[model samples]
Structures are given as C-alpha cells and as structure tokens.
Target: MEEKEPAPGGLALIEALVNTLDVESGTDALDTEENRTRFGLTPADTPGARELREALRATLLAHAGHHPATGPRPPELGRLLTAAPLTITIAPDGGATLAPSPTAPGAPALTARVAAAITEALLAGVWHRLKCCEAETCHWAYYDRSPASRGRWCSMSVCGARAKMRTYRARTRPA
Candidate 1:
C-alpha cells in the first residue's frame, strides 16, 4: 500500500472535524463526552457544533466531486460561519497561526480556527486538493497527492476498488 499523504495544515482541521462521524462503522464520536474529548470537541447540549461539522464535511465532499451527495451548504452553516470569525497572527520569524477571534467562545472558537485555516488554504490554491472519499461507506477525508489533483478516494485498494467492483457487478448483472 502506498503511504497516504497527510492533509495540509490548513485542511487538517476540517479533516479532524469530518472524521468524528465514522460512516463505515455508522458510529458517531460526538455522541459521548469521552469520544468528543478524544477529538478535542466539547459536548455541547445543542447540536449546533455537530451541524456545523457536518456542513463542513458536506462542503469538502462537494469539492471532491460529490455534488450530488451534497447539494447545497446548509443555511445554518452559512450563518454560523458568518457569526464566528477567526484571527490569524504572523510571527516576526514569518511563521503563521490560525486562531479564533479573542471574543469567540468555545465550540465556535474551534470552528472559527478551522474556518480560518480553510480560508488560508483556499487563498493559497491548495484547499481544492483536500477531498472526502467518494464511497459513501468510507467517506474518509484525504489529501489528493496526484500530480493532476484527480484523486477521489482515501485509497485505491479499499474504497476505490470497492466502488469499481460495485459498478462492474451492476453493469454485468443479468438483465
């Protein structure tokens, strides 16, 4: 198996948020405090944070050519992002960091930080390479390392092969 490349720093935050819901196992890490904490997510009584994370997942999947699966960005997500702004600081040594605005609170703060990183990556023209697996069961987020930026799955051996097999079977099925 090829060693998969990691997502760029900016998109890593989005990848972290998306993987909390394991599609293959049909499990959600955000359902419990322990699991959420494991992912650096706080368990909020409201579903706002999870919804935002799902919206982010949908956005990235769409970028990966899953437009049919993710039609439009939810309105609530648009509102949430607009409400929470991030602050980026540059060090004298030319390093940079993405953080939530000083006034941003808890979950939104984290989300803001993710938003900031995504924005930075987008401006740098590298955000488009970060994509979610096309296989509905996997839905893993991966960085497209292909020279042409055409990768559509986490691994060709796993999700890619499964998709191909499914398509072949469907096409060859007795009619």
Candidate 2:
C-alpha cells in the first residue's frame, strides 16, 4: 500500500516476508514461482511459507497496536520460532550472533532464516519497529522510523490520510 525504506539488517527479511501477500488485492507473491524463488521456497514449501507469513503479519500488526479483524487465527509466532534450528557463531571480533543451522533446503531453511532474523532484531532492539499498517485492507509491513516509534500507518498519504478522513467525516456527520 505504501513504499518506504526497507527495515535495517535482518529485519528486512522479516519485513519482506510479511509483505509477500498484498491483502487488499488478495495477490500473494508466494503464489508465483519467481516470488517463491526469491524467498528460497520450492512449490512444496508454499503452504508452510503462507502459514509463516500470516503469523508474521499478525505479530507485525500487534507491534503497531492493532489486531487483525478477520481470517482464521494464525499459529503463535513464538511457537514456530522456537522450532527453528539456530546456532551461535563467534565473529572475528568475538561478537556472537545467532544464525540458522545448516539444514535441508525449502521451508525448514526459510523458517531457520526467519528465526535468526528475529533473534538478530531482538538483540538490536529494533524488532518492534517492524510493523504492519493499521489499515485492515492494506496491512503492508513497514519500518517505523518515527523518533517516538508511534507510527501507525505505512504511509501518511495513503492509509493514514484515509483513516483520518473517515474519523473526520464520522465526527461531522449530521445528527
């Protein structure tokens, strides 16, 4: 629904995954071979990928202080993350980081990558900045760059404006 800078570091991967489905148009990028390839998913991995995507979306919405209004409840993200295999690596500078353990390709690999990304973002204290827009129809994922981290929409010109206008009209409607 809006265009903005990608989230920094591994958060970008999370953001990209959450946005694979354009909710307003019902166009899931994962449905296409090219898009699936972009995320290292095989055709057989699509179902698991979609499940992960929805769970991520729900979590992102919560980050923005919103709840999804429809659709079946997604599996808990924490549960899924806990199942991914991760390993700790010591960098040349002695900095330790969590990384996906080498695994068979496809959904398992993708889940490991996502788990690693979330771990990195959590350590960096920027995990919550990755949010989904408040607009139910356009819950696109975005990085909240606001200094106060109070951003609620993906774009002020789009979802934000629309929401504000709706409020304005409701408040001014004839009694």
Candidate 3:
C-alpha cells in the first residue's frame, strides 16, 4: 500500500506560538516585578521556575494563528506530531520573516508539541537555512538551503508539475 502525505501539524504549532502569545510582537514588554502581581509572572509565584515555565505554557501551546487570504491554515502536522515544524523566509536583502500556519479561532485545536517546534524554528531563523516556497499562487512554503540548489517544488509532483504542465500545454495549444 502507498503511504499518505503527512499533515501540517508543525506549521499549526508555529502559528499558535506567534499568534497565541504574541511572542514576536510583545517580546520587549512581557514581564516585570511590578506587573508580577497584576500579570502574576514572578519568581516567587513562579517558584522553582516550574510556575514560570508553566505560566508561559499556555502561550507556548498555541497551534493556530491567522492568514490574510485563507483566514487560517491548519497545522495538520503539529496536530499529529510532538513538535510542529516552522518554515522561515529569508529575503535576498537579509531580512528574516516568519509565516504562521492558518488558525480558525481562539486557540490550538490540537497539541503542545506543535508550539515548541515553531518556537525552535523561529529562533533558528536568526541563523538561516529555512525559506518560503517560490510559487506565487500557492501560499504553502518550505525551508531550503541545498548547495546544488536541489530544492525546487514544495514536494515533487505538486507545485513543480503544476508549472511544467501549464507551460507545456500553453506551448502545444492551438493559436
């Protein structure tokens, strides 16, 4: 029997990390002793680092976010696996970008491993190696830094052939 393609669970974890906690956006202003009482984020309340870690636990478990066009892209992989994979986009000009998996609403409809994986990927983006898919119409992107430029389609038969088939038909079609 043929194996089926895996879900985008990792991607969902990524979106959840960025969107649920607003980790990227609110990094600079999150915690402090003063707000500890109000926000309840302090070493005392968060004793032994367990509470601290747990406090951020909710923020860490998000498995979905938002997409402009589609509204939300489910991180099917994150849902399936322990840690959802995160795909980073590095521009030619040396800019780093993160694309979150689409989310439906409130929070993760699945697991926590997805969020951890996304956080890991975003942190790694600082170095490089990840990238978005080149196809314009298809928003689904991937990470690639192969030496021989062996990277092409997001998979093999999907985006790659879509282009080739379109071009071939256009070339052979009647005027």
Candidate 4:
C-alpha cells in the first residue's frame, strides 16, 4: 500500500498558532504546562511557542484598537482550516463584505495580523489534529477527535501499532 502522507509540520505551525488563541480550548489549555505540550505546543513561555503566541496577541490587539467592539470577538473566530481567500472588508456603515482577498504587492504584505490569521487557521484544527502523541521518536501526529473520538494514534502503522505491540509484549513477558 502507499505510505500515508506525512503530517505537515509547517502547516502545524500555523494551526498551533491559531489554536493558541482558541477562546475555549487554546486559552484554557495554555494556562498549564501539560496541556500546552498535549496541544503540540513548543513552550511559548520560553523562546519558541511563547514568542509566536505573544506575537499573535500583539497583532490581535492592534486590530482591536482600530476596530472598536462592534460585538465581542467571536471567541477566536470559530475555526479555519485555511487562510480564507475571501477579502474581509468592513464598510463605514459597520457592514462587512467578503470579496476576493487582495494579492500582496511585490512579494506580499507580511502584515502581522494576516500572518497571525494564517497561523491560527492552520491550528484551528479545522483540517488537522490539535492533540499529539504521548510517545517519542515518531512524528506520526494528527488526531481528528470526531464525534466518535475514535482517533487513537497519529498513524496506526507507526505510532499506534507500535504502542500496542509494546504493551502486548510487556503483558506477555514473564514477570
């Protein structure tokens, strides 16, 4: 059989960024160390993850400053699997419109807010798993906790099966 596609770590970077701002899960989970790692976070408190999180916070704050609270922020903008291509515009009348997103001039505008939005969409868990493996050495990571919550491993052939085999051997071995 063909090998399964590897989880996109690059994309994971974006998703994790967004998940960090998840009004419900991300915010609540970040308050603790274990939850942070469980969410595949890279310790924003130190250098890696914390830095990104802070950067996102700054972007959101900047945007909020410009746009007064028409209504409360939608608890982290729900979830997005991809950087929506729609051009989100707010008319002076307070109405919003979704047209095609503008292309960045030259290479592209590296706006902080847009960057944050992209990252968040990646972790929105819209297209990927928010949780990761308990085992080391395996990058098999991506769990979709659907209604069944049947997801048990990043990849059964890699992480899940290995875990199962290890457990079986341990139980079968002479005590």
Query: Where does model 1 exceed 4 Å of error?
Result: 1-3, 38-40, 68-77, 88-98
How does each model score on TM-score?
Answer: 0.80, 0.95, 0.29, 0.36
Positional deviation of residue 54's Cα in model 1 after best superposition, in angstroms: 1.0
lDDT of 2 by residue, 69-90 (tens): 8667888888887778788889
TM accuracy, model 1: 0.80
Superposition TM-score, candidate 2 onto the true structure: 0.95
Worst 10 residues of 2 by lDDT: 97-106
Clashing pairs in 4: 14-119, 15-122, 15-123, 18-120, 44-49, 44-50
**RMSD after Cα superposition, model 3:** 17.0
Best by TM-score: 2
- Candidate 3 lDDT by residue in tens digits, 1-175: 0122422445433322222222224332224455333332343432322222222232222211212233344333423343323345789999865443344111222223334445555565521222223344432333334564345444447666877888899999999
> Relative to the unseen true structure, what is the C-alpha lDDT of residue 161 in candidate 2, on a scale of 0 to 100?
95
**Model 4, clash count?**
6
Q: Count the backbone clashes (under 3 Å) in each candidate.
A: 0, 0, 19, 6
Superposed by TM-score, candidate 3 places the C-alpha of residue 50 at a distance from the truth, in angstroms, of 30
Give lDDT tens digits, candidate 4, residues 1-175. 1144433544444334434443323344466777565544434433434444444433333322322234534323322213334466789999764443466321112222334445544555443343333334322234344475446444667667888999999999997
Worst 10 residues of 3 by lDDT: 59-68
Q: In model 3, how large is the Cα lDDT of residue 164?
A: 84
Show where candidate 4 strays beyond 4 Å. Answer: 1-88, 91-128, 143-147
> RMSD in Å for candidate 4, one decimal?
14.1
lDDT (Cα, tens digit) per residue for candidate 1, span 1-175? 2356568886876776777778878787779887666545556622766777777777667778885254554534466687666776899999987677888666777668777877788778998888888887777778888999888888999889988999999999999
